[model samples]
Target: MTWLVTGGAGYIGAHVVRALLDEGLEPVVIDDLSSGHRGFVPEGVPFVTASILDGGAVEAAIRDHSVTGVIHLAGFKYAGVSVQRPLHTYQQNVTGMATLLAAMADTGVEQIVFSSSAAVFGAVDVDLVTEDVAKNPTSPYGESKLIGEWLLRDQAVATGLRHTSLRYFNVVGSGSSEVYDTSPHNLFPLVFDALLEGRAPRINGTDYPTPDGTCVRDYIHVADLAAAHVAAARRLEAGQPLEPAYNLGSGDGVSVRQIMDAVARVTGIGFEPELSERRPGDPPRIVASGELAARDLDWAMRHSLDDMVRSAWDARRASTP
Candidate 1:
């Protein structure tokens, strides 16, 4: 059986493609190259350069590859940018998801492992968010992801399609290859860039109620996230009952100061960070309890915060021109 991986050339999607290959499954990729790089697609996998919003192109790719399942990872993901451009976020995340689902229905593809986000949980007061947490998105990006989950659930109920939505927290670390790096909007990559350039990193918002007076987030290794995606796809293929949603994250939360310290420890960079005012709609703390995913999908994180930072530092070093 072949799998269609949307955005397979992207940072996280490329790692998923590598995992799929490791499982001895063929993966066909579709990406528009807007934010994804063509060089990241592994050799011998059929890759189509097209947007998911184009129904005809998506349908053609599905039919050509005999795709039985889809790992949907293509969407807008910048939280702060989404607040500035709500319409674009909704169009790419919500409307584009509808277009892909319609294509899947047309082609009789019944399984999908969607890449959702923990931002869907919004500003929850709980220490650890679970699958049953009430979803109240705080930004256009988060709202778009919540709507994507609703679309998946509605399609499953109405069409007998089996799906799994992995609501991930902060995705960090580098893949085995140095070709893939962090997203430009992410905190770690920005810090990495500053350190590489002999510049000071900037820390935004230090008045939050967290232990370090900084925002706290659960950072999951990219490889671990990819493993969960493969597991979800395998379970769905086996006709297992669909889970409502799975939270993919480490159970522990790391603050911004902690991350900065890790970077300094790993890279020997002692540059002080520039303090800045908080960005709008920034959550004080967001941590995930992966017990549900651990029980249902047997997913567990193997990398530590030190490991994540070290691996990222190594990749950043290798990527330097």
Candidate 2:
């Protein structure tokens, strides 16, 4: 079956596209290239350079490719920045999602897999977040993701749209040296950039109540995340039941210091990370249980912490030249 991968030129989207191909499924890409790279989409995959908000363009891609389903990943995804640009965030995420759904509905497309976020459950106190956790989004980005899920839920009820939203925790690592995380706001890229420039990576909030006096978060590999999307799509195609949402996360949490240690070990860098005060609204710990996803979507943390750091570092280094 052919799938439409929105934001397919981006790091995670690109990985999803490749994963689709690996499973003998066709994938058509539609990306605005706002924060995505054209080179990331593999050759021979049909590419549409348009925003998801452009209903005409989105409809055309859906119809032209005979897309059986959509993996919606296009959006303004910066949570902290979304706080300052709430309107832009809503425009891209909320409105863009509505537009995409409208186009899909108009075209009789019946299935979709949304790329949701753990941001929907901001600053939780839980040891392991499940899908039923209270959603109190802290920023427009998170709010928008929650709204997108609502859109899907409402549409599913109204039109029998088969769908599921995957709530990602902390996505890291590379499936291939060809595709790597490029977000300036993400942790892996920031740390790698600091080390490459011979500067110490800064660790915000070493006074947190966690074991290492730092924040703890669930980290999952990009490849594993991609596989989950495929599983969801296949399940939908097979007319199997699925939860409205699933947290793509590590059951156990990893501290900031542990990530730093992994980076140093992988890169052979010995510099200590600079400790600083916690950023406002930053949660000390937020890990999630992927039990539901594991049961339904074959979700698993296939890469170790060091593997994540090494693969990401290697991919970033490969792009340096």
Candidate 3:
């Protein structure tokens, strides 16, 4: 059986593809190269360059590749930027998801592993977020992912589409040196870019009430995340019962200050991060309890903070000219 990995050429998507291959599953890729790189698509993996908004194209990829499932990861993912480009974000995530689901329905593709986000929870009054928390997404990107989950759930009710959404935040590190995090908005790349150019990396705020006086959040390794995705797919394929959604998170999260320290230690660059005023809506902490995920999806923090920084730095440096 083959799996159609939408956005398979992306950073996380490419790692998912590699995991599927390592697990002996045939993987096919469909990416429009919006934020993904064509070089990330491995040789011998059948590739189709197209948007998920194009139902005909999605359907063609599903049918032609004889895909038994889909790992949907293609969408507008920048939370901060989505506020300024709500229309584009909604179109890519909401409307595009609808288009993909339509194509799946048409082609009788039943199983899917949706790449949801922790952003769906937005600001929280509690410390340890769980699946039961009220979903009040603050950004357009988060709202779109929640809507995507709804699409999957609704379709499942209507047509027996086996699905699970993995909600996570701060997906860092590289599973392989070939696939690095390239997002300009991500913390890792921003710090990495600064270090590469012999500049200081700055923290937005450093006076929060955490142990390190900085915001703490889950920072799961990409390989670990990809492993959960594959496990979910296998369970779905085997008709094993699974939850509707699971948080692929670190039970205990790391702080931004801790992360900066790790970057300095890992990259061999020592500099104190300059602190700026806190960005509005930025919470002091946004950690999740992955106890449920650990029980069901074989989820664990296989990489330490230093490991994440080192691996990501290696990949990013290798990719640099």
Residue 41, candidate 1: how far off, in angstroms? 1.3
- How well is each residue in 142-236 modelled by candidate 2, as lDDT tens digits? 99999999999999999999999999888999998999999999999999999999999999999888888999998999999999999998998
Q: Rank candidates, TM-score, best first.
A: 2, 3, 1
Please, what is the TM-score per model? 0.96, 0.99, 0.99
Q: How far is candidate 2 from the true structure (C-alpha RMSD, Å)?
A: 0.7
Candidate 3 lDDT over 106-141, as tens digits, reads 988899999999999999989899999999999999
Location of the lowest summed lDDT over 10 successive residues in candidate 2: 275-284
Q: After superposition on all CA atoms, what RMSD does each candidate show versus the true structure?
A: 1.3, 0.7, 0.8
Off by more than 4 A, model 1 = none
Report, for every candidate in turn, its global Cα lDDT versus the true structure.
0.89, 0.94, 0.92
List, residue by residue over 1-321, the lDDT tens digit for candidate 1: 789999998889999999999999889999999999887888898999999999999999999989999999999989889989999999999999999999999999999999999989888998889889899988999999999999998998999888989998787887775445658888888998888788899989999998999999999889889989998999888888758789986887899999999989988878788889997767898889999899878789888888898887887788777
**Model 1 — TM-score against the truth?**
0.96
- Give the better candidate number (2 or 3) by lDDT: 2
Give the Å error, residue 309, model 2: 0.4
User: Which pairs clash (backbone N, Cα, C closer than 3 Å) in model 1?
Assistant: none
